[model samples]
Target: MYRNLQLLRSIRYSYSPPKASVLLDVSNCIQGLKQKLQELNELKVATARKIADYDPMPKLEVKMQEEGFVIKVLSQRSCQGLLVFILEAFEELGLDVLQARVSCADSFTLEALGNKISIS
Candidate 1:
Protein backbone atom coordinates (compact mmCIF):
# COMPACT_ATOMS: atom_id res chain seq x y z
CA MET A 1 0.00 0.00 0.00
CA TYR A 2 2.87 2.49 0.78
CA ARG A 3 4.57 1.54 -2.49
CA ASN A 4 1.37 2.31 -4.36
CA LEU A 5 1.13 5.73 -2.67
CA GLN A 6 4.77 6.49 -3.50
CA LEU A 7 4.19 5.49 -7.14
CA LEU A 8 1.18 7.84 -7.35
CA ARG A 9 3.12 10.72 -5.90
CA SER A 10 6.00 10.19 -8.30
CA ILE A 11 3.64 9.99 -11.24
CA ARG A 12 1.83 13.12 -10.13
CA TYR A 13 5.05 15.05 -9.71
CA SER A 14 6.43 13.88 -13.13
CA TYR A 15 3.24 14.56 -15.11
CA SER A 16 2.37 17.94 -13.58
CA PRO A 17 2.10 21.04 -15.80
CA PRO A 18 4.89 23.60 -15.47
CA LYS A 19 4.37 26.41 -12.92
CA ALA A 20 3.97 29.97 -14.24
CA SER A 21 7.01 32.14 -13.60
CA VAL A 22 7.03 35.58 -11.96
CA LEU A 23 9.55 36.77 -14.58
CA LEU A 24 8.77 37.97 -18.06
CA ASP A 25 7.02 35.55 -20.42
CA VAL A 26 9.48 35.43 -23.31
CA SER A 27 7.38 33.25 -25.60
CA ASN A 28 4.37 35.56 -25.30
CA CYS A 29 6.55 38.59 -26.00
CA ILE A 30 8.06 36.95 -29.07
CA GLN A 31 4.65 35.98 -30.39
CA GLY A 32 3.36 39.56 -29.89
CA LEU A 33 6.36 40.98 -31.69
CA LYS A 34 5.82 38.61 -34.59
CA GLN A 35 2.19 39.69 -34.88
CA LYS A 36 3.18 43.34 -34.88
CA LEU A 37 5.80 42.74 -37.54
CA GLN A 38 3.29 40.97 -39.74
CA GLU A 39 0.85 43.84 -39.34
CA LEU A 40 3.53 46.35 -40.29
CA ASN A 41 4.46 44.30 -43.35
CA GLU A 42 0.83 44.28 -44.46
CA LEU A 43 0.60 48.02 -43.96
CA LYS A 44 3.75 48.57 -45.97
CA VAL A 45 2.38 46.55 -48.86
CA ALA A 46 -0.88 48.52 -48.77
CA THR A 47 0.97 51.84 -48.80
CA ALA A 48 3.08 50.74 -51.77
CA ARG A 49 -0.03 49.72 -53.70
CA LYS A 50 -1.62 53.07 -53.00
CA ILE A 51 1.48 54.88 -54.23
CA ALA A 52 1.56 52.80 -57.39
CA ASP A 53 -2.07 53.62 -58.15
CA TYR A 54 -1.45 57.32 -57.63
CA ASP A 55 -1.05 59.42 -60.76
CA PRO A 56 0.89 62.60 -60.26
CA MET A 57 0.24 65.82 -62.16
CA PRO A 58 2.51 67.04 -64.94
CA LYS A 59 5.87 68.36 -63.91
CA LEU A 60 8.09 71.11 -65.37
CA GLU A 61 11.61 72.23 -64.53
CA VAL A 62 13.71 75.04 -65.99
CA LYS A 63 17.28 75.98 -65.30
CA MET A 64 19.11 79.09 -66.47
CA GLN A 65 22.52 78.33 -67.93
CA GLU A 66 25.22 80.80 -68.82
CA GLU A 67 24.55 80.50 -72.56
CA GLY A 68 20.86 79.56 -72.57
CA PHE A 69 18.05 77.96 -70.59
CA VAL A 70 17.38 74.25 -70.13
CA ILE A 71 13.77 73.20 -69.84
CA LYS A 72 12.26 69.81 -69.00
CA VAL A 73 8.62 68.78 -68.92
CA LEU A 74 6.94 65.49 -67.99
CA SER A 75 3.33 64.34 -68.27
CA GLN A 76 2.18 60.94 -67.08
CA ARG A 77 -0.71 60.99 -69.53
CA SER A 78 -0.57 62.05 -73.18
CA CYS A 79 -2.20 65.36 -74.08
CA GLN A 80 -3.38 66.08 -77.61
CA GLY A 81 -1.68 69.40 -78.37
CA LEU A 82 0.72 69.94 -75.48
CA LEU A 83 3.70 70.35 -77.80
CA VAL A 84 2.03 73.16 -79.73
CA PHE A 85 1.11 74.91 -76.49
CA ILE A 86 4.70 74.73 -75.26
CA LEU A 87 6.04 76.12 -78.53
CA GLU A 88 3.54 78.96 -78.50
CA ALA A 89 4.52 79.82 -74.94
CA PHE A 90 8.16 79.89 -75.94
CA GLU A 91 7.34 82.17 -78.87
CA GLU A 92 5.46 84.50 -76.55
CA LEU A 93 8.48 84.58 -74.26
CA GLY A 94 10.79 85.52 -77.21
CA LEU A 95 12.85 82.39 -76.70
CA ASP A 96 14.35 80.51 -79.66
CA VAL A 97 14.66 76.78 -79.29
CA LEU A 98 18.23 75.73 -80.10
CA GLN A 99 17.72 72.03 -79.49
CA ALA A 100 14.91 69.77 -78.31
CA ARG A 101 14.23 66.11 -77.48
CA VAL A 102 10.66 64.85 -77.28
CA SER A 103 8.96 61.53 -76.49
CA CYS A 104 5.26 60.78 -76.86
CA ALA A 105 4.96 57.01 -77.15
CA ASP A 106 3.37 56.19 -73.76
CA SER A 107 3.83 59.40 -71.81
CA PHE A 108 4.93 62.92 -72.79
CA THR A 109 8.41 64.18 -72.16
CA LEU A 110 10.13 67.28 -73.52
CA GLU A 111 13.64 68.57 -73.00
CA ALA A 112 14.57 71.75 -74.75
CA LEU A 113 17.43 74.21 -74.76
CA GLY A 114 16.47 77.78 -75.61
CA ASN A 115 18.07 81.20 -75.80
CA LYS A 116 16.51 84.64 -75.87
CA ILE A 117 16.25 86.00 -79.40
CA SER A 118 17.84 89.41 -80.02
CA ILE A 119 15.22 91.90 -81.12
CA SER A 120 17.73 93.74 -83.33
Candidate 2:
Protein backbone atom coordinates (compact mmCIF):
# COMPACT_ATOMS: atom_id res chain seq x y z
CA MET A 1 0.00 0.00 0.00
CA TYR A 2 0.98 3.63 -0.39
CA ARG A 3 0.81 4.16 3.39
CA ASN A 4 3.27 1.31 3.96
CA LEU A 5 5.69 2.89 1.50
CA GLN A 6 5.41 6.24 3.32
CA LEU A 7 6.03 4.48 6.67
CA LEU A 8 9.06 2.70 5.22
CA ARG A 9 10.36 6.02 3.90
CA SER A 10 9.99 7.60 7.36
CA ILE A 11 11.80 4.69 9.00
CA ARG A 12 14.65 4.93 6.49
CA TYR A 13 15.04 8.71 6.87
CA SER A 14 14.72 8.82 10.69
CA TYR A 15 16.65 5.57 11.36
CA SER A 16 13.74 4.61 13.70
CA PRO A 17 11.27 1.77 13.60
CA PRO A 18 7.90 2.54 12.07
CA LYS A 19 5.10 2.57 14.63
CA ALA A 20 2.51 1.26 12.19
CA SER A 21 4.63 -1.64 10.97
CA VAL A 22 4.82 -5.16 12.36
CA LEU A 23 8.61 -4.96 12.51
CA LEU A 24 10.02 -3.86 15.84
CA ASP A 25 13.44 -3.78 17.51
CA VAL A 26 13.38 -6.31 20.37
CA SER A 27 16.14 -4.37 22.15
CA ASN A 28 13.82 -1.37 22.50
CA CYS A 29 11.44 -3.36 24.73
CA ILE A 30 14.15 -5.13 26.83
CA GLN A 31 16.47 -2.17 27.42
CA GLY A 32 18.55 -1.44 30.53
CA LEU A 33 15.61 0.20 32.27
CA LYS A 34 13.45 -2.88 31.82
CA GLN A 35 16.18 -5.10 33.27
CA LYS A 36 16.57 -2.79 36.25
CA LEU A 37 12.82 -2.71 36.86
CA GLN A 38 12.64 -6.50 36.72
CA GLU A 39 15.43 -6.81 39.26
CA LEU A 40 13.81 -4.25 41.54
CA ASN A 41 10.46 -6.04 41.38
CA GLU A 42 12.11 -9.35 42.26
CA LEU A 43 13.92 -7.81 45.22
CA LYS A 44 10.73 -6.20 46.52
CA VAL A 45 8.80 -9.47 46.27
CA ALA A 46 11.54 -11.41 48.10
CA THR A 47 11.74 -8.85 50.89
CA ALA A 48 7.96 -8.91 51.32
CA ARG A 49 7.95 -12.72 51.57
CA LYS A 50 10.73 -12.68 54.14
CA ILE A 51 8.91 -10.05 56.21
CA ALA A 52 5.69 -12.08 56.04
CA ASP A 53 7.52 -15.09 57.54
CA TYR A 54 8.05 -13.23 60.82
CA ASP A 55 5.47 -13.03 63.60
CA PRO A 56 3.32 -9.90 63.79
CA MET A 57 4.11 -7.63 66.76
CA PRO A 58 1.64 -5.34 68.49
CA LYS A 59 2.04 -1.58 68.86
CA LEU A 60 2.79 0.36 72.05
CA GLU A 61 -0.01 2.13 73.93
CA VAL A 62 0.71 5.06 76.29
CA LYS A 63 -1.81 6.33 78.85
CA MET A 64 -1.35 9.77 80.41
CA GLN A 65 -1.17 9.79 84.22
CA GLU A 66 -1.09 12.42 86.94
CA GLU A 67 2.43 11.39 87.91
CA GLY A 68 3.94 10.82 84.49
CA PHE A 69 2.49 8.23 82.07
CA VAL A 70 1.67 4.53 81.93
CA ILE A 71 3.05 2.65 78.89
CA LYS A 72 1.74 -0.71 77.73
CA VAL A 73 4.04 -2.21 75.10
CA LEU A 74 2.72 -5.34 73.41
CA SER A 75 5.23 -7.43 71.48
CA GLN A 76 5.32 -10.96 70.22
CA ARG A 77 8.51 -11.87 72.09
CA SER A 78 10.99 -9.42 73.62
CA CYS A 79 11.52 -5.68 73.72
CA GLN A 80 14.30 -4.96 71.27
CA GLY A 81 16.08 -2.16 73.21
CA LEU A 82 12.71 -0.40 73.53
CA LEU A 83 13.10 0.02 77.28
CA VAL A 84 16.46 1.76 76.79
CA PHE A 85 14.95 4.05 74.19
CA ILE A 86 12.07 4.91 76.55
CA LEU A 87 14.50 5.78 79.35
CA GLU A 88 16.59 7.92 77.01
CA ALA A 89 13.49 9.74 75.79
CA PHE A 90 12.39 10.48 79.37
CA GLU A 91 15.89 11.67 80.23
CA GLU A 92 15.92 13.89 77.16
CA LEU A 93 12.75 15.53 78.52
CA GLY A 94 14.60 16.11 81.86
CA LEU A 95 12.41 13.68 83.78
CA ASP A 96 14.03 12.00 86.76
CA VAL A 97 13.35 8.31 87.27
CA LEU A 98 11.57 7.74 90.61
CA GLN A 99 10.91 4.00 90.33
CA ALA A 100 11.08 1.29 87.64
CA ARG A 101 10.08 -2.35 87.26
CA VAL A 102 10.40 -4.87 84.43
CA SER A 103 8.30 -8.03 84.37
CA CYS A 104 8.63 -10.97 81.99
CA ALA A 105 6.75 -14.25 81.72
CA ASP A 106 7.25 -17.62 80.03
CA SER A 107 4.74 -16.53 77.41
CA PHE A 108 7.46 -14.27 75.98
CA THR A 109 5.83 -11.04 77.16
CA LEU A 110 7.83 -8.05 78.45
CA GLU A 111 6.33 -5.21 80.52
CA ALA A 112 8.42 -2.25 81.69
CA LEU A 113 7.17 0.21 84.32
CA GLY A 114 8.74 3.62 84.73
CA ASN A 115 7.66 6.31 87.19
CA LYS A 116 9.36 9.60 86.43
CA ILE A 117 9.08 13.09 87.95
CA SER A 118 9.84 16.39 86.28
CA ILE A 119 12.74 18.16 87.97
CA SER A 120 11.57 21.53 86.67
Most accurate candidate by lDDT = 1
Q: Measured by TM-score, how close is model 2 to the native structure?
A: 0.36
TM-score of each: 0.56, 0.36
lDDT of 1 by residue, 39-107 (tens): 999999999998897677888999999999999999887788999999999999999999999998888
Any runs in candidate 2 off by more than 4 Å, and if so which?
A: 1-55, 104-119
Q: Say which candidate scores most in TM-score.
A: 1
Could you tell me the C-alpha RMSD of candidate 1 in Å?
Answer: 11.5
Off by over 4 Å in 1: 1-53
Instruction: Please give the lDDT score at residue 3 for candidate 2.
Output: 74
Candidate 2 differs from the real structure by a C-alpha RMSD in angstroms, to one decimal, of: 10.8
Query: Mind sharing the TM-score for model 1?
Result: 0.56
RMSD values, in order shown: 11.5, 10.8
